[model samples]
Target: MAGARGAAALERDDPRRYGVNALETLLEGLVDYAGLFPPAALPMDDAVRNYAAYRVGERRGMLARFVLPVARLDEFVRAASRIDRGGDIGPWPLSVLAGPIDASVVAAFNREHGARWVIDSIEAKATTVGEVNAVAAAYGGLIVYVEIPVDADPAELVHAIGAAHLRAKIRTGGVTPEAFPAPAAVLRFLAECVQRQVPFKATAGLHHPLRGEYPLTYAPDAERGTMYGFLNVFLAATLLHAGTEPASLVELLEERDPAAIVADAHGISWRGLHASAAQVAQARSRFAGSFGSCSFEEPVQDLAALRLLPPRL
Candidate 1:
């Protein structure tokens, strides 16, 4: 009898063969937990419990971060006290939302928790260049992500984020039809980030594995809205970062057919062009970061249902 090796152990010697290796290459540690936000807005207690469970669950390989609001830091710590954790789970890495990137505050929290938590990133809303600069100045070392308004001119703001050596953030979609940015806008934001060499993370609304019209909420009568599939956005990003002409990117982002995506160790193809897993991984590491979602199960389950992820045991 032997313990199971994780996703990292599924690599291929050739690095060009498809299957588990390629899937791992594409999805290794992707989703970030934002269960406190709208639609599924789980309470601090419930969200913390879900995060702790997922960190040790079978789908843990797909988990990347826990998004906690700045205002709820106290609540999170208090709720986290009741969840029993083993040594194997490690410190819960967090992306604190709406907080000043003050190292001392984070230090105090870490000091109190005895290595149960570590905060290395902060997500702040910035609608202008000056605002972005203002937030970037507050933190000296932590990765500060400034969420830019997609409706405004993101070029200058994105440039500022890059110049300030900070990361960019976007609200990819939300609970309403209007919450989702248009394909052109998303493509614009991603292209600008690539042009400016700024890394970014997406929050809210993206839960499906492919682009399609899905219910906006857990409510039965919730109106369906077109949501950007994580695959469409990330794959388009890989191509954009690799210097592929982005004219087709608009269509790529708007693409819905799961059959349109063909992936292997060599690379993944949407339509006719290809982007290697290493190239995509580089884009993920250096440019596009993890996306925030309320349900960890939805995206993983969707990917599995689509045959993108290996079937459950």
Candidate 2:
């Protein structure tokens, strides 16, 4: 495919943009392998219909999942109620996005639908970690995921989230690649999550599959009144955690070679992403029996399949 030329182009680009502080030339060669495949983006929306439509459009790729963020439990219930009544869309898995303050909502949702709720810790109150942990423990069987800021001390977050039987996810924004976490740090976090047996997910600023510096855009949401792509957060984190070294990670980000990273197989080695299909199935089965089992779906299934889980089944 565009592997060779893409690699060369990446070498010419600035590796700093991809969040690696390593030898540029080495990073380029390492990233070349990632050029063989592509990355997928989840549909972004605040409206139920829009999210449903996004899921419908995501059937074409492996990473077409959907996440819904709510500020309150009432909002989540209202939205879930609407989705339940809106009729089935397809096979996409729908996760309810909530933060530390939304624990009551998560509890309420779990009570109503069990594992149908995915607790999200987006922009949460750090000071209330104990409260969040309590809620997470209360709903131990549900999919509890937390979003750690780029600057947040992941060690503590990981421990706190894990103790509560919740997964920890790293959150990012469109800052310079230099500001992104180190590959070693990302790997350590992933490894820790696996060791702790917690599954995590990423969100926002990951529109493209590969790593690269783009002219940051300011697409603000009218409702939330927030701008998008402020720091290229997703791309940087993907590069670091995509099962590669600092060099290759930087190369992919500099070149924006989504295809390369996906094909490398070794490059995108997230715990769930690279696990054997059987293993993934087992994980899903295990999750199904946990407090987070309501939204359990096979991780080995492509993103499209995962996204379609709630709607199709």
Candidate 3:
């Protein structure tokens, strides 16, 4: 089981490496880290929609995963095109989490129209394993599993999500400081997912560089929420599952700034970025190689050009 999970983690394509709170992080990460793109949540209101459009337009070649309420597909499709008026950003991939409606309808729409999209079925709550499998079989393109907040064990979530045919997005932490999963615990959880052969992505709470003591800030959307540094979460997963050590992971996070972190070629430095880059590249090279097909270089090139890390050799 463990070996299978490791292989799965190493095998999945284009595991999105970054999530942002406001457009600032989104834009900054894109401009600075080439591969990092913001998964902007779809806003129900027109004012918020305009803001999202502005961000998307400015960050062309960056992938945008827009979340929409299942019922608002028509509005989402319309808004999505308008946001990409120059046709540079997208037909941005649309993602729908589990809700009241049958997920197949969304899949059917994408299939018929050749739309780029993904569907996340929140586990232990609105969606079931069968539902996730059915949707993955139907859509086949960019299926993700969302593990929502609850008392359920991460192991169970990993096993269940792994069993399904779709790819997975494991949310070990969120905006709330209390909600952040322990680094060791997250490592264990990721290891389990790796063992199960589940390919996943993460969302929310990760804004900083590493795990440890720090002042927490509230999320814009939620009053009580706070986000962690991106380095902390990303490094933890890489160390535990990517064959790096806790000590090395700590070294990368301990750097004073992004520049220092990006400079160290030997220590967890710029080489760290390649861990994700190589994993993504291999996944696409083996599985699919078309435009909509998954590839790590897309994000890696973006990140390299952005100077998020030393240029990829």
Candidate 4:
């Protein structure tokens, strides 16, 4: 849901930009801040502080999980305790990055910490179908997103993931041009997930809101690549799952024109078709889940530059 406070702020600043209200709803809790990851790989203290600030600020509504590796739960716990002000900032929900799931560490940490830190999700890599299934069964109630190989036939792994009732994960972009898969490959992955009724989340190289050529790293002279837009990926996924015009997907994923993607009070419109907020909400709830970014502010600032997040917000 869109935050009432944010809408009210926008209403006062420039009432006309309130259409951004609808756009804001489209991204509510849509990004899992991965400040622990590449590019803007801040230290645990810095990431924890930034997350705490965001959790209590205006854009808090847009904030999702604080992403960190499972191994550093203690580091986060220590850093967070000093800054969190005893729940004033957060009992932040987290999505742990791990390989070969053994959630006991996470479960034990949460149990002894007055539940101040809850590791409710795991994003793990899977090499074989059995590994995927084993992870699914091991996590019990914790939400598990299995990142499988998108290079070869992903059907069997996707099928197994779907059957086990775990969300699928996709690596949409990366540190190098070669790290990002072809647009068609991504589309195939999303289509298969949708076709299989399996929900998915995206990660990596999606710092910007729209797909365009961008730097692969934070270095001053970093190499550039064609990065997919978080907006394009999510919108394409939702529209595809809704059984909208199937052929439009390629263009949708590759669309660099932010103007081509618009949101009115009614819903999100791209090119020519529309997806009702209800439908997009459904997609967010069940089909296409959230993406991870190292800097939450980068995405929000991009939206602001596009006037999708006006001064009021």
Candidate 5:
């Protein structure tokens, strides 16, 4: 589970300039940049530079907040200072990992450097109502997401999260096959969240556009795992919200053929099921929040290959 604290939308690519489409609606502000995390665990300076470059790139529409841990805020400040050439660079938005840190830590960081950047949201882990309530009390007034364990039934914890008026989070995948939760587990989590009207963001092992077996790491011969595609996950949420049955959702979650899904100006369709541009936009802006990804380029490149996105953008 990962989270950051604070509220308000980040500065992202203006979709109007490109003319909004179903695919664009489905994906805008859909990726929270997590370059500092595993697999592509980059050094601070490199990750900072990469995020800086992506903020102004064409596909910035799909980008969201920069995910950083509170412990490394000082390191981030120092590294970010090096690339602090003004212009359209920063005043960057951030989603901080709230690990054993108080909201005061983020408050202090913002007090000193709020003008250049802001930590608007936070991610934290919780398994019980006490932990969920504790996180809410500690970080009240900011957007908070509690990551719950899907390995076991998360209904109780999901209820706690919804009752608290907070959001939900799920770990879709990690570096190993063991890290990926079963499709049934994912479906149940999504179902519970939607039933409770809890919005969610996903993290880990979702850099690709479609589900398939892929290397767990960047090493020469990393172990392979069946990864859940971001499109599969997000679209499943969209369709689930539209009242698609649980069984169909499981199939959608495990969909592999790029041909099985279609995206065009009207909206995106999978099998015979379709969601119009408005429905896609509503689902994304409301229920299906973004997923965290280590590399922004991977999803973009994959989408381009599927011809869902232009090669240039």
Candidate 6:
């Protein structure tokens, strides 16, 4: 697979972006907008419009790159041009989903649109060490994350990723109950990544901030299923990075009660376990990165409802 290089340096989160002191360190650029994917599965124009709006929105600080397929770069350029006529809404960053690796396509897109747009990262799958090595070698100049299966041990694949100096990705949930990984499986993935000194990002089925039963989709009759919370995933990863025990990590991921969790200026705590604000910031910036979400509003709304966010945010 061919890939391009060049992602701007990661910027530290400004304190003013989110007023919630407790969550400010954990949530900066925590969401990568993936509106084009399933569940939401928005049309291209609508997705482009939504991302452009988010770039200038109040909670923009919480948002990260726009996620799109590499093949749709042309379509994105056209749509982005139409929506942001003054070029005021860009230079938009993107994390392109890769299919067959074509170096020229990605490189050409960056050459033409690098000023107003950037292909900062690429996300692809690698079920084996060889695949991980190939992806790391091909995308050496850019930030690359390899998605590995979590049904079994991911130690070798994760180790390969760490050795390649790249990152890992996990699929946390989907449209059905079966789509969500068991809490133990998620815990294992986090533990592996932490032990191997590998950072990871997650995608799919993480719209809400807390784990609970929710409608699978937007349809009126959409069946509901238990979904893992973004807070749960990140917090667990943060704790895992800080040397918290595995048993405690599993409880954090499986915890559903909003009252059982606490987020304040000092830190975030679940039950009696605690991770200080400095620890949260370090874990997020180093080991645990952002997750891809189909709907940005859902997360923001959910956090506001939990009073984890300021009223104006």
lDDT (0 to 1) per candidate: 0.78, 0.36, 0.40, 0.79, 0.82, 0.81
Write down the lDDT that model 4 would get.
Answer: 0.79
Better of 1 and 4 by lDDT: 4
Go through the candidates in order and give the C-alpha RMSD of each one to the true structure: 3.8, 13.9, 9.7, 4.7, 3.8, 4.0
- Per model, state how many residue pairs clash: 1, 35, 23, 0, 10, 0
Of candidate 3, the 10-residue stretch with the lowest lDDT total is 1-10
Give per-residue CA lDDT, model 3, range 191-286, as digits (tens): 565567665556554433433443333235444433334544444444445555544554443333445433222224344443444332333222
Backbone collision tally, model 3 = 23
Alpha carbon deviation, residue 279, candidate 3 (Å): 5.6
| Candidate 5 TM-score, C-alpha based | 0.91
Model 4 misplaced regions, further than 4 Å: 1-21, 86-90, 310-313
Q: Estimate each model's TM-score.
A: 0.90, 0.49, 0.57, 0.90, 0.91, 0.91
Better of 2 and 4 by TM-score: 4
Model 5 misplacement above 4 A: 1-19, 310-313
lDDT of 4 at 161: 93
Candidate 2 lDDT over residue span 98-151, tens digit each: 554565765665456544433322323233467557546444445556666535
Candidate 2 TM-score, true structure as reference? 0.49
Q: At residue 22, what lDDT does model 1 achieve? A: 46
**Which segments of model 6 are wrong by more than 4 Å?**
1-20, 85-90, 310-313
Model 2, runs deviating above 4 Å: 1-46, 58-66, 72-94, 97-101, 109-132, 150-153, 174-185, 218-255, 262-313
* Better structure of 2 and 4 per lDDT: 4
* lDDT at position 248, candidate 5: 75
Task: Write model 6 residue lDDT over 18-70, tens digit each, in one string.
Answer: 33465666777888999999899998999999987776677866788899988
165-202: candidate 5 lDDT, tens digit per residue: 88899999999889999999999999999898999989
Task: Please give, for residues 226-306, the per-residue lDDT of candidate 1 as tens digits.
Answer: 899988888888899888987978898888888898876566788888877677656755776778899989998898888
